[model samples]
Target: MGIQRRRSWRFILLFFPLLVFLPLLFSVSELHRNSKELDQDLGSKRSNKFDHIVLGPAAGEGLSNRLQCSGLEALNKTHLSHISHAFNCSEIISFVTVFAVYNSSQSDEKLSDLVTVGNNSYSKAARSMAILNTYINFIQVSMPKSNVIVLSDPASELLIRRNNVSLLHIQGDYSRGMLMLQRIKSYIAFLETRYEEHLQGKHHLNHYIFTDSDMAVVDGLCDMFHKYPDFHLALTFRNNKDQPLNSGFIAVRGTPDGLQKAKIFLQEVLEAYSSKYMKASRMLGDQLALYWVIKSHPSFDVKRFSRPEAFMNEIHGAQVLFLPCAIYNWTPPEGAGQFHGMPLDVKVVHFKGSRKRLMLESWNFFSSSGSDISDMLCLILKSGRTKYDF
Candidate 1:
């Protein structure tokens, strides 16, 4: 009996450690398995989030092929701004302006030669500053309740701020190429950031109008919304070919479909920049990329406007409504003097090409004459408020 009792005690002691260690070992193994599964789930979610954000084409395939194969519906929704159910076009429309200026050794010389400011020699950056300030002030006067955002380099942020414009500083080396590529990238970046803000419920705009620094608004654009209520996107054209659209002025609706199209367009532009075909074809710059996007994607509801007297001219293609160019994107006739008369209905002036010199001259004339700057420069002078000079 004693020997049997001793054997039983030994068995209990030996088996007790096994009973405890086995359950602990099983628990640890189960925990490890669960942790691995959780990690995999998170990884998959992350991958799915970024699945549609293809900045360029994938390996071993051309961009055209990749675009054809990938269904836009399968694109990740989180990367885009959720269309607000409460969007009201009347109350929310934003004007987006972007400028990129690099300070180089020849920048001053470039500015002085680009636009001569009477006897005063202003640096290229200085002229840019003056132009932007005038543009902002004009917008404020014409569209007092409108939202304005300016995206620019850090050096120009203060200048933009002084004009009571919302400034977003761009960070990068912008000293490369003709800067047109960088401008397009900046536009995309701003759109992405705005999308993020909308997702966070911080932004509520349903429409956006993007313009360049050298343009000024002289009249209200409220009628444009009423006229083009159903249009998704609108772009100005420089000619009838509808080949290369001017990206300087663009209007976009913030609908889901519109945002999706914009994303696809920007992605295609990136692809073109990196593709060898672009190099061979000499299809360089943002304008060519835009032309390609419009050509490639025929289903995007885009309108092109071009009428000599319209606010924005050089429009082509079908379904395009003409706005008076004399008002919206007014550029003086070649060889015309700065004091040349313009139509009374002129709403905006675009100082493109060699016409930039006229902008400074007109601004000076109006400011000195005590004439209402809101009126077209030529109209004010024609009213006999001041004599035309220069």
Candidate 2:
């Protein structure tokens, strides 16, 4: 009887371990199955979300059909396909200029008053036309081989005429305050369209440079492209102490990562504008949205130019290269003895603030032959304004 009891105890000890382990083994199997199912579900949901955001709900549609329906295939074939990538600055970069012109009936009294040039009271649309014309003329003289694309309303198309330049009429209400955020959206759309064109074997563009209509190119930007080969995006610093970066002048490279960053920037701006909390905190505009984007993205290869005397002052991600403001984005300061003529080194002039009134004056001065540029530079250097000038 004692021997029989010993055998039974041994059996109990062995079975006891099995009993404890069986439940745990089954539980672990169940958890693994559930985890796999959960991952699949989440992945599907994420895919759907991405589709809705990028393709406008009809994500199943074929690429060719969408391109054909959107009339982008023709554009791609015409503008993108034939271009070659030879590492030449002109071949790699295209200058994109945007303008929103309003007629007398659409513009307010303030805009109307601002439009008047000298003795003639021109419409706001006419003034914008003049500004764009001057810019185009300057670009032609300075960078004849450079590619230019102008985005404007249909009405303003009549004013711009250049054989080498491409004109795209973007239909939208670009009134001063209404749909202000849409400007950035439009820019993203244009960039994406170009990207698609590149993917379709139509064109090969490495970079896009964006500027406002009031801005004019005084020199070729080939050196800048050669200088920053790795940077994905370049931004000019705003003159305002509160706003450090200006979206007015942006140079973005054509890469998957760069495009994705731009999309994120635009999305964040849209979300911030829509958010009630953020809307109340600050003035909701493209500049503010850009500020948020730059601050949010610390990893991006963003180059900021932030010298007080430089045209672009502060970049968010990288060190400042200190490009001369007298050449890049020369915004003339206010005060007596301020030089109004274009300096030799000035590449582009961005007319901002009350100094925007000087756009017409500068445009006329630069277009004419009689202005003494040397004397103007002397006056600007003598006046204390050039120290902190934008």
Candidate 3:
């Protein structure tokens, strides 16, 4: 009996060590697999480059792909304002044209062919171009994403694919004279339909931003998000005729409820737009709709600024830290064209129509009175991070 007991004991001792090491062995194997997966991802990112990357000579030309684009100083700063405000954003959409007429110049049936974006839709194209351009620049320096949404089917899909950004198409029968709804209603419908998919996209990130294709991002809004995650993602409201809040740029909590609310508001607001008071709003149809809709929902806190510095404007100040106007209407006389010969301090150049032309001209003209980044560097070395850079 003693001999049998000893034999059993000896067997237990031998096998116990193997049992103890089993979890450790599996853990090491799992960790190795995870590490390998991570390595493959990093390798893929390294090889993939932006296709339409346009790094101007003045804007960190030849800098690493991660470098901040545009002439905006790459310094991060305090963005938290009073909690009274929330993140401002708008519909992730596009329009055929502001004009009433419809054209058959293009067809999605020919996906293989190069679709020419006609200049007749110049205003819409320019505005959308600015939005897309800003989106690319924002991704380079800030939170880059693989998915992007463009209203309707665009030929830009191939270009976006080459750049490694996934294109999401917003569908609509924008063919012709339909009286059931107008431009704003169509946009609302698209968001409502796609909201669920958008919410599910959080498998990759926590936040999602939707802006009117007209608005250009000048600086990284990441600062705002970092400061306030719980804050409602709202937008700057416009109270005046010239200075109005654009719902074009919007930030949401990336939830089904938020998407539902946005759609609900858009639908309810269309009726408001169709109302006599809204029609009287004349030039500001969407603004009128938003102003009234916002009033209805106290939960959504939308902010409006009266000055050039609030969101983005042409009003240049020699002493304040400017975000280089994410979205500025630069149609001549009203601060049109680029601020020529101005210091490289301007982070972005928003071209608004004739104003856009002016800004591009001014960009050539917006020269330094001789003090370039070299002089600025000398000054930075002499001083440190201070209001002096303003």
Candidate 4:
């Protein structure tokens, strides 16, 4: 009886505190659950109220940390010097962002629908400019020393002038297939002009990145050149089977030999764009042109054994490197989860089609002055407003 009594006493002692605190713990847990529910309700309300703009998945996670401008030197292990090294300040690659603000007719015809976000209705031109402004702002903050060029028509020039982004005036119907061909011609001419200056010792080796205006750069690009130093041209590919290559983002090395190689590869692409497939109007866009050129190459064979697997083939004596679209030219769906890698590792985000609104929203959300988004858009969309310095 004594032993049993002692055992019972020990059991009571062991469970006494739990008995006393069990109700308190449950009450605290319920309180927390209620608080979490309230926060979610508030968040949903805010989202509906600001449905005017598209927000990134990381809107609340703070995108300022993803800028990566401050970590350039540390990441590249170079002082960003203007010397003869890769990605030098002087021999830097120029980033080319293209947009079509007006049609070929020179009338006030709208190319895209006027997007009504919140209380403001933005014209196609205004939306294009706003996205371009976001891109320029990103480049200025992330790559101040690198050159940025805008390739568009005269109508676009006027809208672009407000931001002081370098303009490459192109004249023509700013439509799809036509614009793609014009981009090739204009880019070739620009390269030739720079090459001529290089012969006169007026320029160093030139390089360029052709990208869409609706894209944003989260990481510095020095690593790309350094990692793929051997290739003259690099193309990014999507997961689509029919139109796998994405021509929106291309990296070109402008050394004399590199230029020759790129010219050969691009010439093939240009010819393919005009081929019978394109004439049949079988959706033969630039992406299709790239696909045909790549697939038709004599040395093209799928070698799937390599790590970070990519397609590499010889094109008319030039080495062409094909990169995955996930890392280079990400076109993720709206409201998708976070990227696969670290945010700083994500080089570019192509906010194509309707997702262009996300660029504006992301800029506003990440900018130091978050509330100035409408004010900034007004400066672009309306007149008689002070220019917002990019």
Clashes of each: 15, 13, 29, 1
lDDT of 2 by residue, 41-67 (tens): 998764441101011111112333111
Q: Write the per-residue lDDT of candidate 4 for residues 1-390, one digit (tens) a residue.
A: 999999999999999999999999999999999999999999876454222442222221234433122211122112223122223444477888666665434332463445554344666446656777778876664566677887777655354453436777766556665776766666666666666676678877768888877777654667667777889888876556567677788888878777667766777877887773455332346677777888776777533212334566676777887876656776544212223322333456766654566566556644644422222222111111111111
- What's the lDDT for candidate 1? 0.53
Off by over 4 Å in 1: 1-90, 104-121, 154-159, 176-178, 242-244, 255-257, 273-284, 297-327, 333-345, 373-375, 379-390
Please give, for residues 194-274, the per-residue lDDT of candidate 3 as tens digits: 575666673323444554433323333454445444433345432344434454445544456555555565566677777
Q: TM per model?
A: 0.58, 0.58, 0.44, 0.64
Q: Which ranges in model 2 have alpha carbons more than 4 Å from their true place?
A: 1-92, 106-121, 153-159, 238-240, 255-260, 274-284, 297-327, 334-345, 370-390
Model 4 alpha-carbon drift over 4 Å, by segment: 1-91, 103-121, 154-159, 162-164, 170-173, 279-284, 302-311, 334-344, 369-390
lDDT of 2: 0.53
lDDT string, candidate 1, 1-390, tens digits: 999999999999999999989999999999999999999999876444210112222111222211121221212111011112112224456678876665647655663344345455556556667777667766666666667887766654355445446878876435545356556667678767666777778866567778877776766666676767655456655433544355567666676545445555566675665452334232246666666655565554334323242332221222323343444555553212123334444456676654444556556555565644432343322222221111
Which candidate, 2 or 4, has the higher TM-score?
4
Local error of candidate 3 at residue 191 (angstroms): 4.0
Candidate 1 C-alpha error for residue 187, in Å: 1.2
Candidate 3 — which residues are off by over 4 angstroms?
A: 1-147, 153-164, 173-190, 193-195, 198-206, 238-243, 276-283, 295-350, 358-390
